[model samples]
Target: MTQPKVTLVVSPRERFSYTRASLESIYANTDYPFDLVFVDVCSPESVQTYLKATSQSFKILRTDHYLSPNQARNVGLRYVLDHTDSQYVVFIENDVVVKRGWLTRLVNCAAETNASVVGPLTCIGNPAHQVIHNAGGQCYIKTDFKNGQARRRIKQSAYLTGRAVADVRDQLHRTPCDYVEFHCMLVRTDTFAMTGLLDEGMLATREHIDFCFMVAQTGGEIYNEREAVVTTDTLGLASNKAGLMARFGQLKLPDFQWSDLPYFMLRWSDRWDRASLDHLRQKWNLAEDKYFTKRYAGLGSRRHELLIQPIVQYLTFGKGSPWLEKLLISLERPFNNYWFNRYAQRFEQS
Candidate 1:
């Protein structure tokens, strides 16, 4: 059988310093041959010049549109669809430095499982003490801030209590996940032909999550290749987040009630004003299970604990909750994490 052609796509957000490092890592670590394409939306001239001059093997497409990361990705992918006869397209962020065998593993997994999307386990933060970063955890809406401060929460993992990245890497096995961050995901080109590209309107957040749902809805299973580890400083997070918030005239701070986070919740939960959850729920036939169902598990009070505060905040926007109640919430988190991690293991297996 003929090997399928592959195109590696990279669209750097802000700094090119990381882009150079990331590109070098890809060329060094990737075991298979691939056509490389870099899409830049207002990246530094030095980075562009370097890429254009350095590699005759790859092509750099630079546009001044300054589009959102998702839009920029679609733009890059549009080029891939038009120019390359690639059977597979992989998107790796400019900020990530990949590990050896990362690309091979993703490609093999996709071929083996016939997975629509397969991504490596991303390690973010300090290399020594990394977190699962963007390797899909329990997908849910985050609420419960206290006096303009964020609260600790638990996500689904094997240990069921993935407090850190090690928790994810500790038990290495392939598992079906709700979503895989696009930072380093391999997708069959036909998947796009079916579900289309990233939703350009999402701008900054939830685009990948939305894409996962789209793929899954289209009979595509998204999986994590636990053996393929990508050591990225960012756990698949969008760069220039500060600039994004600034553009919206919103400042992100520890101001207890993050005015910025709700932008993400808009796609989920009727509790939030700008929600499209009903439409999404209908689109995917989503319900209490396989969505936020895992996130609802915790130390105590699953549905009640999950919805009560969100309901209050929705009814009152951030003014309704009392400080004493906030204190109680803070005190309750340890136990909550304990229960969430313990119960969430079921979701990981599902």
Candidate 2:
């Protein structure tokens, strides 16, 4: 009997040491035959030497161009689809490790649920932890008040995060979600061929969100398998951010370019204006600032006379304290009223 085939893609350009362990963990734990694909983008000589010296059997696509995750993914996916007969593609970031049976659960869930995409419960270490790092999530716009600021600023986010609460993680099987982030994802071979690849114009930011939105537009469901687990080193951006900054400085990396705001608005916004940003912030129960910019700096305001008239409702309406108050007003928008759907008509699926 032939074992089922899986193709895994990983890009390692930033951290060399961590990626070595990441590769070892996969080779050590995975139980199935997988065609491992690595896109080498301007990796240092030492890193390249290490990869070449490895005993592991894998294929490497070499390039000098700086391909964002979004672009590199396309290069590898096209290669897999065109050169191999694998029926599944798994995309995992470099700083993560998978344990025994992790791949099994992801494959099993995708098979049983017939989902277009199946992702696992991501924890915070190689041994894994209770705190859920990433799961089934949705795109949301938010506003918040801060010290030394005049007016609230608008931001976009995924609705659920933080230490995985018991209720959210208490599940026997896969669950449906608006979309699943790409930290670790197992997708059907046809998902890309059918729906097309991530938008190159958007670069690395919010491409997963946009991809999920695109999946929804095609009437496909994304599932999160609770049992399948992987471990990550960073929590999106906030948790291990200080360490990340130190790495950037240590590596003497150049400035980083982020394009979540205008790119997302241009892709999904109904108006792509301040009103749309503010309305989306109120519509979605998002909190915190993932990607702040000069344009989103707001009316130069802060938390003062909040109860006073003209206060930003966002002050009390987010994933923070004052649960009852936030919950009551949060229901103003119906649950099924996904803002992405409004743009489904104009958004390009293919």
Candidate 3:
């Protein structure tokens, strides 16, 4: 039996430090025959060197300027669409590690069920396969009328988020779903013709939801293949930290090296988040409501917690006083703005 032709496009999710681990895992776990196209966007020297040395194994496309996750996917998608006869394209992030038989399971699900898109059971943190990030869930637009005005809003949810995979192992199965994350997803290559290139305007968030919405609009089916498991290493943040942060508003900072500061800041910048949300609102004719309001208000939360809080903690001997956090954030805001603007300009010119 001849194997299906597939192309795997790996792009940066947020940081470059996990590049080697992610790439090595792909080669080690995946026995399926497929081509690889890696999008290297302004990664550090070490990452660049590693990709260069491994260039013989796959196609490496590099850019000196930074790009959003969607933009990076578009770069690889365009290349695959133009140069290769791949029947399917899998867009995986640089930090996601796949388990054995992951790619084969996704391909088999798509082939057997005729799903236009297939996503694995994505887990998070250390002991990567034990806890679930998302198994698949609901995504749709809800419309309401107030004061004789129609308003539309995006409604999304992820199933089994934070649940231990061992507890729900029997409940997992292949089923249709409205949304799957970009952490790892497989799409029929020809489906791009109907959905168009991923919206580059989704610079900070909602890119996955937007893409899935487009696919559904075109009458394409999406499925969750529970047997295909993968986990994301979220910058060394323990899995429990996310739960604690959500429930009690506690934060444990991840390991962010100095070299990662610029890209991390730009990727989670308030400016990009606001722009992406605004674009989604307008493009989908969504009305401004509490969803947008909360999103807008929390735009700087990531940078504040991940970047500023760490410095404050270090200086204050682990106290991380609120006042110190505020002061450092004020001091860092200008630099963040300047660097992101400079990178944006470079991206535009490129």
Of the candidates shown, which would achieve the greatest TM-score relative to the real structure? 3
Candidates' TM-scores?
0.61, 0.62, 0.91
How big is the RMSD of model 3?
4.3
* Candidates 1 and 3 compared by TM-score, better number: 3
| 10 residues in a row with least lDDT, candidate 3 | 239-248
Query: Candidate 2 — which pairs collide?
Result: 149-301, 149-302, 150-300, 150-301, 150-302, 151-300, 151-301
Regions more than 4 Å wrong, model 1: 138-170, 234-350
Worst 10 residues of 2 by lDDT: 300-309
lDDT of 3 by residue, 1-350 (tens): 87889999999988888888899999999989989999999899988999999889999999878888999999999999999999999999999999999999999999999899999999988877989988999989999889998889878778899899989989789979999999999999999999999999999898888899999999999999999999996565563243222225444344444677678888888788889999999989998888889898787777776666665665666665888888887887787788878887876887
Name the Cα RMSD for model 1: 14.0
lDDT for 31 in candidate 2 is 81
What TM-score does candidate 3 get on C-alpha atoms? 0.91
- lDDT tens digits, residue span 139-182, model 1: 53334466886543323333222346555446667767767887
- Sorted on lDDT, best first, the list reads 3, 1, 2
